[model samples]
Target: MPAGTGGSENYTVGQVRELNRQGVPAQVVTVGLDADDGRSEFNDIPFRSLATLSEVGGLDGTIVFVNEPHTVPTKQLSYLILHNPPPIRDEQKAFAVRGTRNRALIVTSRYAAALWARYLDVDVSTINVVYPFAEPCFAEQPRPDTSAGTTRVLFAGRLSPEKGVYTLLETLHIDIIEQDVALTFTATTAGADKPQGKIIERLLGAHPGISVVTSRKTPATMAALMADHDVVVMPSNSQYWHETFGIVSVEAQHSGCRVIASDDGGLPETDCGGVVLVEPDNAEALAWGIRAAVASGPLSRAARQDAAARFTVKQSVNALLNVFAQPAPIPPATIIRQLEEQVLAPSAKVATTSRPDNVLIETAV
Candidate 1:
């Protein structure tokens, strides 16, 4: 709930709020997350920490686990929001696949559904895709005037190698880019406490064009920050990490910032107009993309309106509620296995209506 938090976790905070606002009562049930901790907005959202995750087995309700898979079995039907890509290690992958058992899996994008279907050997349709929506602030904030001489560029992702922060460093060091006085660079201190983050921040903060600022604490502030910049860069490293869906890409686009992102994973599925995709992990191509964005100039009013309509919280929340109203679409093989083991309930359902009761969201890291 604070700056530098992972996308999935940040997603949890917003989703729960929207769920509650829609009359679908939801509360965060945490495991070892201290509500008193000022490091995050845990105190802001409605959450209660259990002594252990095993306690989740004793609770009654439709359990909706976020990001990570739940470790314990539950009495009521549970749903898992499979946020990250499958683990690379065979053992980890096997464990993750096992965690999906007896749980309806909901991923964020079509690309994620395909990736997980291949990993789990299930039909892609069985894994639902409730595409993430940009917060209202991103779409509502008026785009800043770029008439100011410098073209502002921002790196909004976490300051880690996987996010291509180091690659961005390489791009900035290029002779042509380094000397281009028209371009001004900025980076958020997302993950600045990590070893790699500290190293990157030090290197970037020392640069003549870059300024490393603390990441915003809220979506409104983040939208304001993005609005000030003419371009947003997301060079996600495709070497191992495959982004299921690039929320930052959508947020930036909604904020009317021309995005220069790597064309990998679900980034292409971001679907918002006005993005300039480049080769993943290539500094030269990213630099070229920045130049391309600068050449294109600011987005028109019509383009901003289209982006605002394309990805809204209302659509996402409606889709999510629809998923809740229906039964979990378990594959035939999984259903057979569960039936044989007497684990499949005869009338298994995620929830009863658009606004279900007893919703508990697990914010497991």
Candidate 2:
């Protein structure tokens, strides 16, 4: 069940769509979002809600793929997908408490699993790492050699501080100007149209050659963009948002662009020999990486081959099904007790002490 928009939700939808296309009888069950129950369509996959799951004969034999393990229900078989390490202190507790309810924990990379194991204090052996699959369109496309003179650099994702958009801009301003380069910044909204958004607009406006594309691009569009660029920079900051898996990095590599990513979270894991890893939150390091990437020229055949070998939809689907096939280890009674004691306990004081007028506290028996 997908719970929010981003890479995780996109992965969920992609997996379900692929599974259904492969005649696996898979469908999406959206959680924490308003969707009608039974036989709805989203992203071309059949969707059903938690309430109408049984009506579709899902309850007889089913596994809930929970994207975020917050207030997890332990009655049914479940697999928790831990994409990123808990982003905040409260989420750490929630992940730890609710993670135990799952039969298996899935992660996109080994680094992600390790982070989860360390953060949740769970056995390392219990977590499963299923690398995300890039769509077929993301494969290498024949493009012109962009290695000489000016390098075309592309930055894709949210235009927020957490995404290191500002840091990238700073790098371009300070160091990258010496090197002839073309930079493009694309996102849904410029930092939700905040002051930083104004800063981005000004930066782009002042830099006459720099380009900005404003739209939410699909995978095909992103792949097209990657195919044209010489380098793709994903310089996310760990303190702000630890990137779970650099799916876009993989896409770039597959599309024949050299990737320069931060060595925070799972970007290193996703770098299958074609990526240059740099320290996060450092403009100097990022600039160094960009220069290094440009010097190295376009991705070599060997590097491209290795990068494409890292993940595939077939491999990911097999891994997911394997996890679903396994039975849960913990009893339902134990999970309920853990939820009441560990999950709800921390929130109890807050619930009683002070709650906003808009907030309503509800308990399930």
Candidate 3:
């Protein structure tokens, strides 16, 4: 279900659309607020929403695929697709157990699958790695700007603490700006409903070279935005909430922009022909890397074409279909035992706090 507009939501929607295109019966079931107003963006695929899994029928022998870990009663044929393994908590452990007991578990990256499997101490065979597709944003006309002037760098994501917004700003303050590079920070502030947003806003307010742009731009517009930039920097912290596959990095490569992403999580997996990798949360390293990327010549035409070929929607669908075709099953006793353990274990409490710095900023250039 598309609960919000993030990597998982985008990946889910894209996979569903591709599957439907391949003549597979797939439907999107959404939970939480409808980010797209319940619009069927996919041409032929159908979508529905329900508060709980019990509301739906014919779950028996049906491969119930879930993006996140949650309790969903299903028949023998079911699978769990995890974009990221939940943090260390009793609920997360229970979710792992449920995932291991399913017919198969699909993960976006090997790193994520390994994390889940290690946490649960289960066989890694149960997990299948299926990288998400990068939405193509090829510029209609190449905007080659090799003037040896201030390099323009773009970063797109939520301005959350886990996302390393503060780290990115700090890197600019210590590195990019110091090197006379222009920084463009674009994000969907809706997800940054935390104190971290205030920190990012303050950083933006103080930095003249840094512009925070926010809006749900269409694919074409996004491609134009990427084409205008020389490089894309993804300086994310290696927290539980880090990038899984980093669709933006692939998109940047597709847009003919050099990508400098953190080595943490799945950033290294988006190897767009030796994509630059920097350490997480290290402003100095990020700064040095940004300077090098800015100084380097524009991405070769071959790199962009290769990225487009590697991360197409059709490839993503085929990878998922291969996972679905696998004949993996977990015994029922293990599921019941895990459920019993969950009931016996103390409930893990999680506290969420919201902050007012979540407002979207529209930069007037």
Candidate that scores best on TM-score: 1
lDDT of 2 at 26: 76
> Lowest-lDDT window of 10 residues in candidate 1?
346-355
Model 2 lDDT tens row, 35-93:
74222325577775554323333344455555555444445656667766665678567
Worst 10 residues of 3 by lDDT: 181-190
Q: Is candidate 1 or candidate 3 better by lDDT?
A: 1
Candidate number achieving the greatest lDDT relative to the actual structure: 1
Which segments of candidate 2 are over 4 A away from where they belong? 1-5, 31-43, 50-60, 72-75, 91-96, 99-103, 144-148, 176-209, 331-365
Evaluated at residue 237, the lDDT of candidate 2 is: 80
Candidate 3: where are CA atoms >4 Å away?
1-4, 31-37, 40-45, 57-64, 95-100, 138-148, 179-199, 202-206, 239-242, 331-365
Worst 10-residue lDDT window for candidate 2 reads 52-61
**Model 3: per-residue Cα lDDT at residue 211:** 71
Per-model TM-score on C-alpha atoms: 0.88, 0.77, 0.79
1 against 3, candidate with superior TM-score: 1
Prediction 3 global C-alpha lDDT: 0.67
Model 3 misses residue 194 by how many Å? Answer: 6.4
lDDT ranking from best candidate downward: 1, 2, 3
The lDDT for every candidate, in the order shown, is 0.82, 0.68, 0.67
